[model samples]
Target chain A: MDGWLVDLVAKYNYWIYVVLMMIGFYAMIRKNNLVKKLIGMNIFQTAIILFFISTGAKKGGRIPIVDYEQALAGAVQAADIVNPLPHVLMLTAIVVSVSVTGVALATMLKIYKEYGSIDEDQILERVKNHEP
Target chain B: MNHNLPILVLTFPLLAAFAVNLLGKISKKHVAPWTLASLVLSSVASFFVLIDVLENGTFKYTVGGWLPPYGIELVLDPLSALMLVLVSWVALIATFSALPSIKKEMPGREHLFFSLYLILICGMMGLVITGDAFNLYVLLEITSITTYGLIAMGRGRAPLSSFNYIIMGTVGACFYLLGVGYLYLITGTLNMGDIARLLPPLYESPTVATAFCFLMVGLWIKMAFFPLHGWLPNAYTHAPAGASVLIAPLMTKVTVYLMIRIIFSVFSPQYAFLIHGRVQTLIVWAAVIAIVAASLIALSQRDLVKMLTYVVIAEVAYMVGGVWLGNTNGLTGAVFHIVNDALMTLCFFLVSSAILYRFGSTHFKDLHQLFRKMPITLCVLVVGALSVVGVPPTCGFFSKWYLLLGGIEAGHYGFVGALIFSSLVNAVIFFRVLEIAFSSAGEESVPAEISGSRETHPLMIPSLVVVAIALVVIGINAGSFLSQVIRVAVPSL
Candidate 1:
C-alpha cells in the first residue's frame, strides 16, 4: 500500500489533468449559459495544454538551450536537457485555444443579439416559439 | 516545379484567401475572379499532383527542407492525392454556383464568405496531405474554426447553431490533441510514421490502447458518427445555401478520411483489426444503428435541406462501417464512397441552392410542381437522388455494392441489413419528394412571382449539370478507377 501510494503521488500530474479535464467536460455538457460553456471549453483546452507541458518536464533537467561550444563539438547530452518538442507543440495549441475562444465569444455576441439571451434553454425556447 | 506540386496545391489557396480579403476591400468585383482563379490554379496543381503520385508512387515533402521526425512533412500517397483532387474540384465547382447564390443571399459579404471558403479548402487539403500527427490537429482546427465562422454567417438561429458547433468541435479537436499528447509521451515522437514505427512493440501497453480510444472517439465526434452527431444537422441546415454546398459535402468526408488515415497509417491494420477484434465488431454495430436512426430521422424532416443533412449523417455511417469491417474490400468501399459521397452530396446541395435562390425556401409545400417550374435543376436532383438510392450506372451504386460485398465477406449481417434498409428508406423518402414535385395538386398555392418555368442562374445549372454528368461518368468508369486508384489507396491487409 505504501509503495502504491508513492507511485500514485509520483504521477500526480496525470491525475490532476484527468480531474481538470472531467470538470471541464462536465460543465461543457451540462452548463446552461453559452458563456459558461465557452468557459468550460477554455478550461478543457487548458487541461490538455497542461498535460502536454507536463510531458516535457524532466526531474533534473535544465531548459532546452544548449551551449554553443558543446553543440558544435557534438557532445550534447540529451538526458540533461528537457524535451522541448511538447512545449513547442503546446505553444501552438495555446494559440489555437485562444483563437477558438475568440471565435466562440464572437458567436456568443451574435447569439445574444439574435436571441436576446445567452442561456441555452431560453434560446432553445425562443427558437421553438419562433420569436424574434 | 514538378516536385513542388504537393505544397503548391496547399499554398495557392492559403495565399489567395488573404489576397481575396485584401483585394475585396479595394473592389467587390475582384472577389469572384480572384477566388475562382486561385481555386482553378489549386485544382490544376492538385490534378498534376495526383498524376505525379500515380506515376512515381508515394512520396514525402519536408517543409522548409527540414527532414521528418523533427520538421513537418506532407505525404502524398494515392489516397491523399485522390482526395486533394476531389476537394479542389468540388470547391471550384461549388464556387461557380456559390457566387450567384451569395449575391442573392448576402450580397456584400461575398468577399468575406469566399475568404473563409478558400481557407477552409486549404485546411482540408492540408489535413489530407500532412504526415505529422500534430500537424493534422492544427489543420483540423483550422477547418473547424473556418466552418464555425461560415455557418454563423447565415440568417436566423445560425449563430446559435454555430456556437453549438464551436463547443462540440473544440471538444473533439482537444480530445484529438490529448490523444496525440499521450502518444508523444509514450513514444517521444510526433511524426505519424515515426509513431507507427514505435507503436507495434508497445501495442500491449495500456497507454497505447487508451490513446487509440481517445483518438477514435475524437475523430468520431468530428465526423458526426451516430451518437456524437448532435451538432451536424442543425448546423448544416441553418447555414446559408452558399456555404452548405461546400461544408455539407466536404467537412465530414475529410474527417472520415482522417479516421482512415489514422487507422492505417498511424496504427497498422494488425493493431487496429486483429489486436482490437472485439472493438471492431462493436463499432460496426454502432455504425448500423447510426445508419438506421439517421435514415428514419431524415424520413421525418419537412424541409429539404434538413432532410439532406440527416442523409449526410447516414452516408458518414456507411464509410465508418465500411472501414471498421477490417477487410480490404471494406476499406476500398469506404474510400470510394468518400469520393462518391462528396460529389453526390455536392450535387444535391447545389440543387438545393438553386431551389433556395428561385423560391426562397425548400419546404415541401413550396416545392409543389418544382419539376414543371425548374426542369433542369429537378432533372439533376433526380440524378442525385437516384445515385443516393444506389441505382445502377450512378456512382453511389458501385460504392454501396462494395460495402455490401464487404459486409458479407466480414459476415457482419447486421451491417448488410442496415445498408439495404437505409437504401430502401432513402428510395421512399426521395420518391415521396419526387411525387410531390411531379404532382400538380398544390401548384396554385405557390406564389405568383415564382410561377415561371425559368431555370436557375446560367452559371448554377451548368455546374450542376457538370457534377451530374461526372456522377454518371464516375459510375461507368468505377472499374478502371478501382484498379488504378482505390486498389493502390487501400493498404494491403
Candidate 2:
C-alpha cells in the first residue's frame, strides 16, 4: 500500500494535468455564458501552464547550482540535478496565456456592452434578427 | 541586426501596436500611414531574410546568442522565407485596403483596429519564422487574441461572431499546447531542431505517435480543416470588411504553415513516411470528405460572404489532401498552393469588401444591376472571382494544375475528382454572384447608388491595385520562380 501511494505521487504531476485539462474543457464546452467561457479558456490555458511547470519538477532534487562541498566531496551528480529551463519557458507561456485571456475578456465585455447581454443564445437571436 | 531580422520582424510591429495606441489619442489621422510604414518595414526585413536564406542555405539564429539544442532558435529556411514574404505582402496590401473600410465601419476605433491588425501580422510572421515549438504557442496566442479583438470590432453580429471565434480559437490553442506538453515530456525539449534530433530514435514509441496525432488534430482545428471548421463562416461573415480582408487571406494559411513545420521539421519525412500506409489512406479519405462536404455546403449558402467562407473550408482540404498524398508532386503542389491560395483569397476578400462598402450589404439577392455605378470594383471582383474559380490566366489554375498532377501521381483519382468538383462548385458560386452583378434591379437613381458608394475611402482603390497586381504576378511567375522556391523548401521536408 505504501509503495502504491508512492507510485501515485510519483506520477502526481501528470494526474493534475489530466484533471485540469478535463475541468477546463468541460467549462468551455458545457457553459452557455460568454464570461464563463472566457474563464474556461483561462483555466484551459493554465492547465497547459501546469503541465509545463510540472514537467520541470524533479524527484528529491535541489535547485540546479554549484555547491563547493558537494563538488569537492564528489557527492552530487546528474541524478540530483533539477531542470530550470522548462520553468523559465513556463513563465513566458504563463504570461502570454494571461495576456491572451485578458484580451479575450475585454472583447467579451465589449460584446456585452454592444449587444446588451452576454448570453450566447440571445446574441445569436439578435444576430439572426440583424441578418433578416 | 541584419542576421537577426526575423526576430526584429516580430518586435517592430509589437512596438508599433503600442506606439499606435498611445499616438491615436493625439491624432487618429496618422494611424493609416503609421500602419502602412510598419508593414513596409516588415516587408523589407522579410525580403532581406529571404535573400540571406536562399543564398546561404538554412540559417538558424538563436535568440540572445544561444545556440540550438539548448536555447530558442529562429529558422530562416526557404519555406519560412516564402511564407514570410507572402504574409508581409498580404499584410501590406490588406493594411492599405483596411484603411478606407475601417474609416467607415469603425471610425471611432481605427487606431485600435489597425494596431491589432499589425500585431496580428507580427504574430503570424513570428509563428512562421520561430524554430521553437513553444515559441509558436506564444505567437499563436498573440495572433488569436488580436483576431478576437478584430472580429469584435465589426458591427451588429460582430460581437457574437467574435465570441464564438474566441471559444473555438482558445480550444484549438489549448489542444496545441497539450500536444506540446506531450512532446516535451517524451523528448525533454521544446526547440524544433532538438525535438527533431531526439524524435528520430523514438519514432516507433507510442508516446511519440500520440504527440503527433495531438499536434495534427490541434493544427487541423486551427486551420479550420473540414470537421473542425464550425466557427469560421460566421466569424468571417460578421467581421468588419477591413478585418475580413486582412484575416481571410492569411490566418488559416499560417496555421497550415505551422502544420507543415510540425510535419517536416519536428518529425522528419523519413519517420512520417514510415507510418503505416493505412494511416495515410485514412487522412487522404478525410481530406476528400472535407473537399466534397464543404463545397456542397457552400453551394447552399445565400450570403456571398458566408458562401466564400465555406469555399475556404473546401480550399483548405485541397492543400491538406495534396500534402498528405506523400509524394514529391503532392508535397510541391501543397506548398505552392499555400502561396497561391493566400494571394487568391486576399484578392477575393478585397473585392468582396469593396462590394460590401459600395452596396452596404453582401446579400446575393440584393445586388441586382448595381455594377454600372461602381464599374472598377465590379471589374476587380470579376478578376478575383475568376482567379478563385481556377481560370486559366489566374494563378489559381497553376496551383490546381499541380495539385491535380499530385493527385494522379499518388494514384488517388478520387482526390482529383474532389478537386475538380470543388473548382466547379467555386465556378458556380462566383458566377452566380457575377450574374447578379449584371442583372438589372429596378432603376434606383444613380445619385442614391453614388451616395451608398460614397462610404468608400481612397484607400480601397490602392488596396485593390495591390491585390490585383499580386494576383497576376503570382499567377504568371508561379511556374518558374515560385515553384523553384517551393521545390527547395520541399526537399528539406
Candidate 3:
C-alpha cells in the first residue's frame, strides 16, 4: 500500500506539471486578450517553480539546515543529508521569472495606452492600416 | 588582459548603463559618449579573450570564488568568446553610427535607449558565459526585458510591436524554466556539467524526454524559428533603427548558441541522438517550412525593414536546418554561419538604417533613386546583399558551402534542395529591390530646403563609414577568423 501511494504521488506530481503547463500554453495560444496572456505566462512560470521546489523535497528529510556540525564531525549519515542546491537555484529562477513577467506586463500597459485596447487581434488589425 | 575578460565583457556595459541612467538628466552629452566608451571597452575585452583562447585554451571563472557545481561559473571557450567579440564590435559600431539617427528618431529618450542598449549587451554576454542553468534563466530575462524596453522606445506602432514581443518572449522564457525544473526534479542539480553527467543513466525516463522537448520548444520560440516567429518581423521593423541594427544581428543567434549548449553540454550527443531522433527530424522539417514560408512572405512585403525582417527568418532556418542535420559537418556549418550571418545582418541593417536616415524612407516606392543619392552606402548595401545571397568571395558563400556539404554528407538531399531554393529566393528578393534602387530616376535634388534644414546630422556619417569598413573586414577575413575563434568553441558542445 505504501509503495502504491508513493507511485501514485510521483505520478500525480508529473501529471500536475504537465496539465498546468498545457493549460498555460493553451491560454497563451488561444486567448486573444493580452492581459490574459500575461496571466497565462505567470501561471506557466509559477508551475515550473512548483516543479523545482517539489523535487528538492525528500520523503522524510528534515528542513535543509544542518545545525549540528559538531554532531556530524565524527560520522555523517545519508538520512541527514538534504539537497539544497536545487532549492537555491529555484529561488533565483523564481526572482528572474517574476521580473520578466513584470516587464511584460508593463509593455502590455504601454500597448493598451497606444492602441486603446489589449486584444491581440484588434491590435494587429489596426496596426495594418496605421502607417508609421 | 588578466585572463578574466569575460567579467569585463559584461560588467563595463552594465556599469555604464547604470551611470548613464543616473547621469542622463544632468548632462545630455554624457549618454552617447559613455555608451560608446563602454561598448569599445567591451569590444577590446572580448578581443583579448578571443586571442587568449586561441593562443592558450578555454578559461573558466567562478563567481564569488566558488567552484563549479556549487557556485556560478563563467566559461570562455573560443566560440562564445568569438561571438562575444562579434556582438560587442557590431554593438559599438551600431551605437556610434546610430547616435545621430537616434537624435532624429528618439529625441527625448536618448538616455533610456543607451541604458537599455547596454543592458541588452550585458544580457547576451551573461547568457554566453554562464554555465549554470538557473543563471542562464536570469540572464535570459535580463536580455528579454531590456529588448522589450528597447523595442518599446521606438516611434509609432513601436509599443504595439513590443507588446507582442513581450508575450512571445515570456512564453519562451517560461518554457525554459519549466524544462529546467524537470531536469532538477530528476537529477537534483542545476549546474549544466553536473546535469550532463547525471543524465546519461536516466536517458530512458519520460521526465528526461519531457525536459528535452520543453527546452527545444522554448529555444525555438526564442530563436524565432519558423511557424513560431510571429513576433519577430514586427519587432524588428517597428523598433528604433539603432535598436534594429544592434538586435537584428545578435539576439536570435545567441538563442541558437543556447540550443547548442543545452543539447551537447547538458545531454550527451549519443543519448540525444538516440532518444530524440524524431524531435530532430521535426526540427529539420520545421526549418524547411520556415525557409520556404518566410522567403515567400518576404517577397510580398513593400516595406524594406519588414522585408529584411522576413529575410532574417529565412537566414535563421539556414542555421537551424544545418544544425538539425545531425552530422559534424552540419553542426560546423551551422556554427560557422552564426558568425557569418551575424556580420552580414549587421552590415545590411546598417546600410538600411543609413538610407532610412537620409531619405526618411524605407518604402520601396519612396526610395526611388536611393542608389544615386547614397552612393557609398549603396555600395555597402550591394556587398551585404550579395553576401546575404551567398555569392562567391564573401563569408556567406563559404558557410552555405559547408551547410550544403553537410546536407549531402548526411544524405539529406531534400535539405540540399531547400538550401538551393532559399538561396535563389534570397538572390531574387534582394536583387529585385536592388533593381528598384538603381533603376529609379536619379533625382539627387532632395528639395534644397529640406536638405538644408536636416543637415543629415554630423555623427551619423562617420558611423556608416566605420560599419562599412567592418563589413569588408569580416567578409574578407572570415576564413582565418573562424579557424581561430569558432573552431575551438564547437568542441565544448
Top TM-score model: 1
Q: Candidate 1 - CAPRI tier?
A: high
Reference-based lDDT, residue B46, model 1:
93
Give the true-structure RMSD of model 1.
1.5
**Could you say which candidate leads in lDDT?**
1
RMSD of each: 1.5, 2.8, 3.0
Full-model lDDT for every candidate: 0.92, 0.82, 0.81
Expressed as tens digits, the lDDT of each residue in B1-493 for candidate 3 is 4845689788999999999888997877888888988998889888888888778877888887989787889877776777787788878878866787787788877888888889999899889888998789888888888898888888678877887788788888878887887898788777998999899889989999888888888888999999899999989998988899889989988898888888888987776665678777777878888899998999899988899999888989989898778887788888988888887888778877777777676777766666777677777778777777887767788788889998898788878888888888888878878887788655563322224333255566666666556556766787786676556667532
Clashing residue pairs in candidate 3 (N, C-alpha, C atoms within 3 angstroms): none
Residue-wise C-alpha lDDT for candidate 1, range B1-493, written one tens digit per residue: 3778889889988889998899887888998888899899999989988888888899899999999899999999999999999999999999999899888889877889989999999999999999999999999999999999999999998989999899999999988988898898899898999999999999999999989998999999999999999999989988989999999999999999999999889999899889989999999999999999999999999889999999999999999999999997888899999999999999999999999888888888788888988899989989999999999999999999999999999999999999999999999999998998998764356543552456778889889999999999999999999999889887777
TM, every model: 0.98, 0.93, 0.93
Better of 1 and 3 by DockQ: 1
The window of 10 residues in a row where model 3 chain B has the poorest summed lDDT is B446-455
Chain B TM-score of candidate 2 stands at 0.96
Each prediction's total of clashing residue pairs, residues at least 3 apart in sequence or on different chains, is 0, 0, 0
Steric clash pairs (candidate 2): none
